[model samples]
Target chain A: MSGEPLLEVKNISTSFFSHLGEIQAVRGVSFYLNRGDVLGIVGESGSGKSVTALSIMGLIEKPGKIKQGEIIFNGEDLMKKSQREMCELRGNEISMIFQDPMTSLNPVYRIENQMVEVIRYHNRNLSRKKAVAQAVEMLRLVKIPEPEKQIKSYPHEFSGGMRQRVMIATALSSNPGLLIADEPTTALDVTIQAQILDLMNDLRARINASIILITHDLGVIAEVCSRIIVMYGGTIMEAGNERDIFYNPQNPYTVGLHQSIPSNLAISEKRLVPIRGTPPNLMYPPKGCPFSPRCSYTMRICLEEAAPTIRLSDTHISVCWLLHENAPKINGYSKGKIVDRYKTPSGS
Target chain B: MKAVDDVSFHIDRGETFGLVGESGCGKSTMGRTIIRLYNVTGGEIFLDGTNLTAMSEKNLLPFRKRMQMIFQDPYASLNPRMTVTDIVGEGILVHNIFKDRERQERIFELLDYVGLKREHANRYPHEFSGGQRQRIGIARALAVEPELIICDEPISALDVSIQAQIVNMLEDFQDEMKLTYLFIAHDLSMVKHISDRIGVMYLGMFAEVAESYELYAHPQHPYTRALLSAIPIPDPDLTRKNKRTILRGDVPSPIDPPDGCRFATRCPLVSDLCTKATPELIDKGAGHFVACHNV
Candidate 1:
């Protein structure tokens, strides 16, 4: 791995033009991925995590467009690429896996046909026999038993877990430099989810590819990611290394998300401090901070002015008015203090 | 090829017995079986000591009023065309609980109880958000004043921020109405928080059953331990350091499960005996039930 970043997304903004109005889905979200890094993007539905990934893949269609942003990959600007050029780069240099394996895979086609086609498509010089052989090896790499026989079966013949494994196998067959997995385990069960996560972690180590894992579950992010970015209303609320974000959270939204998750370590006796009110409507986004309505420590300034990204440390940054130096102190809004209040006495 | 085989548990008047499992583990099937939505193949279902399995449809009508269900996908469960008032009031009308203005007032109160405004009563399902739609679903379930509510993955469909709101609302309702819940979900942490007693299911049978704290603090079954360890705790340091028991393969098909323990195919400590005979849900101690040959 070199010192250069694998992917750099700078001030990307995306919007969907519907009949009713324009939805500001991704509002100036930015992040960078390093080589061999597993970066997790944690956000709820309509949080622009999916949209941002789509923007990177150049999958956004009519009515949806990337308004502004510079997506530089391997020192080249992706936005400047032609559709044909982007298409060439999509599966060859960058691979992606979606949430539902059923829809992502073709039900009528055999797994061998799908996996081999992807491998052969990327390596055009390879012979069909070699492609098939590579496909079988990839299947085995994902730990699918009886890969030779299973490869001939249709997607429906495989179980949910097996199908996802097949999807991972197909994605990795291309040997892309960057792998974007969007809620890869959300549709599977917890035990099966663990299996997939373990496989992903193992594959990441062996393949030497940077992974951008997008999910709403903080636990999943904590488990696999080296770095994380918390997004809300399509904006990056906080970005930091895993320990800095988890142990020393500075954003109120991030803190709320951490407290909301019911810890398996202990049965919580008290009610979870739920972030009141629903997510802000993306179509009619708030004038100032999008999270102001639900924020507990919302001051008049929060409702009037957009929050600036405050650098808490060299490795941590949060976009919140509470981080302002002249901001009035709240009981639990102090830097690193909010996370301590919710820490289990026994510790994790 | 039974989806749920010989699963039995009792819920007291005001207790919440949570059923937790991975997808396709028959937790939802168990919930449906209990509510009589799916016919029981070969087991007795007793409600307040009455054999609900023996009752015919005509006789089961009255019991249906006392047993309600909140589905997982609020988007699909509610009729998009129907107004919230009609949707919530439909149950009351069928049960003949109230009439005319009284029914309308009851619907408004149910809406208010679930944290929705009176103005929302006239809106359609499509008009409301996911959490709001779930609230409407809850209002519909509570319309008939049911005693036992089957919450089948109620919070899974909503956003993280909104999940807590629904959970808090459910807890408040449980406290006020003394409603017994058979909550079925895959998320173990949330189940631990809300359930008085929790049952871990695998394939189509109960792997372990214990009081909430006991189950989380000291899970006995290998499947339970693996399931618990697999759950990513929010703390990065703790989760990264925790040793995970990653199962070998995917869950076997339920069509023709192994003759022995359903989990024997993937169990880490599988032995010849495990593949030869089935394990019964036996009481270990202090009401903790485990169904594993090794245990």
Candidate 2:
């Protein structure tokens, strides 16, 4: 928390305009990433976690627009950059890895071609041979066995885990200061996912780069992320350090998410308390808090207007009407009390 | 190619047996084969001590009504053009269990049972969200009133919060109807939570099978150990110090698997004998079954 932030996102709002209506995917989202920090953005489908990452990379396509906000990376406002300028900055200083490795990778091209081209495209001065060597080294760094022979193989030849490794190798080939991984291991098997996560952790220590990990699995976030942001209905429901978010979640949505996941440490006999309903329709999002319909602690004020983000501590913030000073207290509904409801009476 | 080779397990009546494996590991194929959706290539499938694999399509008609399947993707599995009533009542109509007002009442009862309102019966599949569509799928599966249900990754496609809802509903239905379940999924924690016994599959064969608590507490197979170690615990403090037995390579192709063991290709405890002959599932005391030569 001492050094200057590597990336700062201020009040970014992204929306998609279709024939039906304007779908606000991300609204007034703000966060900062320090050097070497692994910040996790955890949310379910349509929670805008992936959209926020895409907005930072300037990859929002037709029908989608960054309606407002500024993205400052290393003291430069990325919104002011031209298309060509953004392209140069993409792989050079900022790289992203997607959920599906097959879609992100060029199927027809060999690993060598895809990786070497990326390396050389970012560093034009480097010779082709040097770039190829760098690509091989990156593959080696990611612990892909037999990089020499594997480099000549096509994407189909590699397994899902290996292809993700290839994607990671390509993403880190240029030593980008910031890496955005959007559910990089979700498609992988658990054992393979562990290997990739270990590889990422090792690389983060060696490369000293910042990472924005986007995933729906809180377990994945808990494994590697230092800080966490809980998203729901295209809004930041809560944000704090990992310990705070997990142990002292203030928002009902965050509490519900935590309780819903069957914990390995807890007794399995206890039933999980599922959140009552589905996510809000973004095309016609509720006038107040989008999560009000599903929240257990939702009050009249929560349905009338959006709750302001209240600071629970120096490092924790949550948007909920229950955190309001004048809000009436509900039985068994407190800032950190919801977590205890899931505890097995017999104890762990 | 044999998608599921020599995989054998039995689900007791009114018991939930979970099958856990990665994609392409043949868990789904096994589920489909048991339900007789796929013709068995080299295995016998017995439901209620009757060999279903040997039955012809005409003869299989009666057994089909006894076992039903709920697919993984509700979005693709449900007919887009069909109304909720038509989808849920189709099974009842086919079996001639009811007609006219009786069928309508049964359909409404099913809708209410799955936690969906009676008004939703007239709506199309496209009108509902992913979770609601899954409820419709469940309602349809329940309409058959089968003794056994094959839930093949039923909650995987749903969001995390919605996943628990469907899981809880399944549990409730199981208690009420005494329906046996063959739950298949890759999510380890959820499988352990819902299942009485768990089977871990690698390639085309089971790596381990035991009671849920026994398998999780003391996994014998190297592949099983690696899989258990790989699951990321939700607690940050616990996960940081956990020693994971990270497997090195990808799962071998099931088309022409290795001679000895399917997992021997990437297993850390592989030996010369492992690559030479396939290991059979051995009984390791207290009903724990393991398929590893080293163990």
Candidate 3:
């Protein structure tokens, strides 16, 4: 909508060189992140949502290589940058918060040590004492009860919700421009999931940081994302604003995802139309659309050919043969309160 | 569907009754309590018109054979070293229902009854997938030929696609054996599909109990209302507009619940009366039972 975008990930293709030949993890994936923007990478369990994020951060491990594409951040392409250069930018310019904080956080180290180190790494000029104080303040911002006391407590001592708060606090310590959250609340209770989402939204406002969230649930994308990218089987099936993706889905995969949700099962269509088949084996993906086997609207072309990207405005786009030239008519049967919700907005 | 709570419902011989709720609620505890699994924790426990709570273990033995439990976790429930044949036929061996070749034959029948191949009877629990292991567990429970089976979150750990299969199998068995079930699980929508009646548990107590359709369609309890509202639907527009009744804090610890109404802490419509007195689960109309200060 404006001059230069903050981050433009151009045609990024990542692959893992396994014994089964080069297994492509991210197939020519391309998207951009803007300042104060919350971009949601939505997909099912094995949709390469996490891998796409890792590629941007240059955190992909050995054997997995970014063969093509440039992650252009502030004019400097992170893809072309040296590993040393990327390391300097990490935690300082771009911070990441992963799911399952217990595994990421060291069992031996105190919470204070990790947080203070992050602050010192980014803003070296600040004193250790001042940084530790800021860490406590950041902990309080995430709404953790007794932050002063909890800071001294180990990751094991805190509950699932509290540990996530600590993780978020640590992510913010560096004052990064972009915050990458990967299924941060999937393990927590629904109530706690809501609170964590609220915290992330509030923190975005406080720090003026852009967010890139990866989650399995589309509803989560609606609640937090300004822009949504629906991925399936290592490729972007659809991209749009929160309104367009949910209200007027173009991709058959996207429509299938909507119908797969359980809320509508009890209301109108008692039948739960789960994606008919399991996700294609990533080791050797199908020749055409990875979702073609499971897609309800599978045409002949959908099996042998890839659909060209259909742009529905500046904000919405989908990749599907159904939208191809004379992309024959299709109707979807999706119902219940949540589906019908976007007709009009409540006076907020 | 009939208002199961309203009908003064009692299962016939070999009937399966399903009781469902979310995490941290007391549905699992209710299963154990009814079966005297926790030694009769405050309830009038009756099985086959016999008072089970008052009966001693020696006397309860005969009645115990009338009931059995299938746990949720397949990985943890079955002893790793035990073969499927041993696991299934153990009940028959214990009760002296069959001996040697007869027990083996009974185990094979159970395996066939639960949709497992008779050939899988000798395999270890570690060798099976989540769904197959659950099938084996069901076969073991059926081997005893119990009238009532307490399925405690049976399919919760399995995949969604696998969930419907297990539920259908259970339904078929219930039809065939006239099995009585206390199906406990956290899947509310699935519960509505499978259960004749639904009981919404909150903070170790039943918030609402009514027929499946009636309870989900028009929930009486505040906690139920809030819980239903908070679930995000796949529909984007409705999800955005639907006023989510986000419960302020998480469910309190069951060990030390609130003074009066257990759900009063998180209930959006909590009043002064809730703090002073616990609400009785009264029959409002059409068999709906709700426990709230004001509904």
Model 2, total clashes: 1
- Global lDDT of model 3: 0.76
CA lDDT of every candidate: 0.89, 0.89, 0.76
DockQ of each candidate, alpha-carbon based: 0.80, 0.86, 0.26
Report the number of backbone clashes for model 3.
12
Cα lDDT tens digits, model 3, B125-211, are 987877778988898888778889989989777655456567778878888888888778765556666677777777666778887
Model 1 lDDT tens row, B1-295: 7789888888889999999988778999999998899998998999888899968999998899999999999999999999999999999998899999999999999999988999998999999999999999999999999999999999999988889889999999999998999999988899999999999999899999999999989899999999989998888778868899988777887898888899998899899999889899999999999999898
TM-score of each: 0.96, 0.96, 0.79
RMSD of each: 4.2, 4.5, 6.9
Q: What is the TM-score of chain B alone in each candidate?
A: 0.99, 0.98, 0.91
Better of 2 and 3 by TM-score: 2
Off by over 4 Å in 2: A330-348
